[model samples]
Target: MSRLVIAVFWLLHWLPLAVLAPLGQAFGLLLYVLVAPRRKVVLTNLRLCFPELSEGERRTLARRNFAITGRSMLERGLAWWAGPARLRAMVRIEGLERLNALKAAGRPVILLAPHFVGLDMAGTRLSMEGDFVSVYARQKDRVFDRWLYHGRSRFNDQLLLSRHDGVRATVKAMKAGRPFYYLPDLDYGRKESIFVPFFGVPAATITGLPRLARLAGAAVVPCVTRILPGGAGYVLELGGPWADYPSDDVEADTRRMNAWLEEVIRTMPEQYYWVHRRFKTRPEGEPRIY
Candidate 1:
């Protein structure tokens, strides 16, 4: 079954962007009507995060997000199997010098990536620049897992450590000069997470970013990927290296992280990943939002 799924995506890989673009939008609309559970999740997230938006406005954003999500799924073919020249042409990178400066200073860098629809585009495009390492939870299905791992690591000298490897392994890799491509936003429960204000909602955010950066003596550079409408392309934007981060207060750093992510989401409302149950873990005595 997994192989069949891969074969479908592989076949889609042969299609031109002009064809795939509108097809993805139409598929997304179909999915919005068909996938009730996920549609509820997306709307629930948007309502909690942006209470100021009118119900109609929020609904519009929800639909657009789904379309972008669908496009991202279909576009994975280009990211995974496309030629180097083709992939390079599809991506326009900004603030790359921020990362380059970190490398020049002999400082290990952590790419502070948030959960966005175009995240894969950012990682794969940047992989072409230099060797980098990222952490991912191993998927359950065996055949598809192998395919995913290979597809992501195939581009350049990229290394993907499983989440089971823990922070010690990540710190070691960063110290060894492999820039850590870190995705800081996600609901992983309250184990290593602290309740922080994400869009004024208390969200369970991982503190691994600050702790790992502090332990590895690395600099944190924010990276964002914006998906262009109608399958035009994507832009991988890098920000300046953070100074005074991972300070004596871990909670403060985590709060700052969430605040920064919220500001970015405002710029491109629909591009942010909204299907996630971001506010799933609530404060003590509080009810669940999803």
Candidate 2:
């Protein structure tokens, strides 16, 4: 079944974006109806994060998010198999000068990327530019895992460390001039994570951003990818390096990271990955939210 899915993706890669984009959205609509568990997760996340919004508004956002998520999934084919020129033409990168300046000054960088739908699109586009280091959680299925690994590393010199590789390997890669593409928003349980307020709710966010930055003496730069409306493609934006980050307080720095991410998500709520159970790990004595 996994091989058949890969075959379908390969065949679909030949279609133009105008045709593929709508199909991806339709696929998402189907999932929204059929995938009850994930659909419930998305709605639950929306309720927690956007309490001010009406139930109808939250449902609308959830549906749009599913559509974008579906598009991002199907578009992996372009990242995996498309020509370099074609991929380059599809993604427009902004604020790359900021990244270049930091590297030019011999400063290691941590590209703080959140879990946006266009994440892989941005990563694949950036990989074309040069080598970078990022972490990946191994999928349970071997066939799907192999396909995902190849799709991500098929481009430039991408050094993908497994979750078990730890901080030492990541810092080593940073010291070697490969910027770390770090995603620190997900719930990785209680260990190595602190309960930080995300949209006024305590979310178990990993403290890796500040720790890794301090360890590697790297500058933290925000890297965000936005999917444009219609079949227009994507834009990967790089924010200026954060000043005075990784302060003496690790928890405070983690809070600051979550605060910044909340603001960014507000800009494009639909593009954020809401299907994941972000509040899965509650504090002691707290009931399971998922």
Best by TM-score: 2
- Which 10-residue window of candidate 1 scores lowest in summed lDDT? 143-152
Q: Go through the candidates in order and give each one's C-alpha lDDT.
A: 0.86, 0.92
> Candidate 1: misplaced stretches above 4 Å?
none
- Per-residue CA lDDT of candidate 1, range 235-271, in tens? 9999998889889999999999998999999999898
Q: Cα lDDT for residue 28, model 1?
A: 80
Show how many residue pairs clash in every candidate, following the order shown. 0, 0
Residues 163-242 of candidate 2: C-alpha lDDT, one tens digit per residue: 99989999999998999999989989889999989999999988999999999999999999999887799999999999
Residue pairs that clash (backbone atoms under 3 angstroms), model 1: none
Off by over 4 Å in 2: none
Model 1 vs truth, CA RMSD: 1.3
TM-score of 1: 0.96
